[model samples]
Target: MTERTPTPMDLLDFPGAAELIAAGGVEPPSAEAVDGAWAAVARAAREEERATMPATPPTQLTSRRVRRPRRLLVAAAAVAAIATGAVAYPVLDMGGEPAATASASEFFEGMAEVAEDAPATTPAYWKVRVETDNQDDGKRTDTNYFDREGRVWSVDADGTVHEPPAGEEGKVKKWPVGKKWLTWPQLEKLPTDEKTLAAHFPKDPNTRFDQVTIMLEDSPAGPELRAALFRILADTPGMKLVGDVRDSKGRAGVAVEITQKSWVRLGGGGGGGSEVTLHTRDRYVIAPDTGLLLETTHKTLGKNTTTPADRYTWLEVGPAERVE
Candidate 1:
């Protein structure tokens, strides 16, 4: 089997993770109740520009590329943590001094600032190109475009351009949220304020975390909406900071993770073996400079394994090409 390499940043990647997910026993993680940011990628470059002017202070430092600070804090969150109480989280701040501890609320709030300050665009089509590094499929990069009318256009790795119908869903689809698949307009109408956005989601933090991932990845959510979502993620309890790292493409970023566990009973004919538990870790790496999601990694770890179950490295997300 093809294996993913382990970097120094795999702090939350527990050894028991792979047994459950690899065996199809575990459900999910950070994708779980307590976890994880996307904006700020735009701000990295913008932050540099702003730094030259000396009016605004950059939340992420200028040296994430040279060396990574300590793996500051770990969240003691359980896979089945409840929604009523907040789990204490040790936050990692990318902008300033390194420490053994900090406030997670403040860390993600920095992300919220960058999300709001990111450069704006009103492109003809919202385009995204992502490369999926799957254990079985090897590797393939695909391009997608979403038009103003909510149509989807796609291009395969072999350069096959698949055009969308004038006003139909794209070949792949858009915004898969909860039981409802939302069109572009409906997505635009999503609540942007913190309270309303939180209330609009399921009260279950686990479900809410996954739904936010869906919106950030597939929907054409604006900067303000993205900012609010960042704040909401900050409010989620027991989030771990995985420290500075790079995506498969070798882009600089910070990783955050949450874990999920599954337990199964093992038995032989007329004999009972001990129950075994497995884990799945969901991790996101965000570029501190650009404030974009550089990668999303999901994996189950064996005693000495580090290969990821699913890996997505976002190569591009901007305006799609216009074909005559």
Candidate 2:
């Protein structure tokens, strides 16, 4: 009688395989079972062949055991591949450039410091001249003055002082009569009310006036004039105080600068305001000892259709005498 060799399933029981079979699923035998089955089949075949052949030495069977650690190592390698894919996903939309940095507050603070140092004050009498050189017209000069009591006067090219009408003159009755060196402290004591200032200057362009001379009558007080002349400087944006120093006239002074936008009225019709932007690079020399404006130079740009680029050269402050 021939003896049947045991199958791999009979050598070891595998719980997972039995459960899968009960669930109506086809499951392969465990690795160890497959290895044993192959070995048993080989031995049985060898015995059958030996019986039919001449006597020969029985062949030794060798088994190689696969460790559980080696199987785990293979599984870990597969999991690493999946984890690497998850980590390498790209989602950033960077244009491959670094971002720019900026500080608006710091920049504005620096500008304020410069503006505060700008030379400004109410002079007892300001001997100012406005010179213009236009391609379509010949060069012209306009010389004017303002007294301590807010009186306005002008000197013609022939060196003649022209006075306003009696009605307007009464507005500046308390103004200084003769030329004198008026300090800032003295000017500050005078009224700076907008109505009082306008009374001594021309009405705005929108207002009524025939010739530029009539507008120069220095009467009919208006708020626009004060804004154009003094308030604009006092409330200038981006103006800042820099430091103190002595001016060319040997007066202790404060330095200031301004780079900001402002408005001013021109002509005499009570006209609308014109926009002005100034970038004052030079330091304004203000007499610190007397709180008077000494000298300054500023570059200005006008957006008004009637105006153009220009530079204001403030000079003759020290030697010139004030008349209020």
Q: Model 1, stretches more than 4 Å misplaced?
A: 1-103, 165-172, 262-277, 302-307, 321-324
Steric clashes per prediction = 14, 27
lDDT of 1 by residue, 121-231 (tens): 666787788888888888888788778676677887777778786534335355655567777667778887876878777765667677876666545677777778877
What tens digits encode model 2's per-residue C-alpha lDDT throughout 1-324? 998886755432433434433445334444333323333333334345445554544464322111111222232322332322221211112143221111111222223333334444433454556553444444566666655454557678888877644565443422220233233234343344434533433332112111111212222212233222333233223333455566544657666554434445655566655644443233455543333345554445445444432322233322135432
- Candidate 1: worst 10 consecutive residues by lDDT? 67-76
TM-score for each predicted model, relative to the true structure: 0.61, 0.26
Q: Roughly what TM-score does model 1 have, to 2 decimal places? A: 0.61
- Cα miss at 224, model 1 (Å)? 0.4
Best by lDDT: 1
Give the per-residue Cα lDDT of candidate 1 at 98. Answer: 30
Candidate of highest TM-score:
1
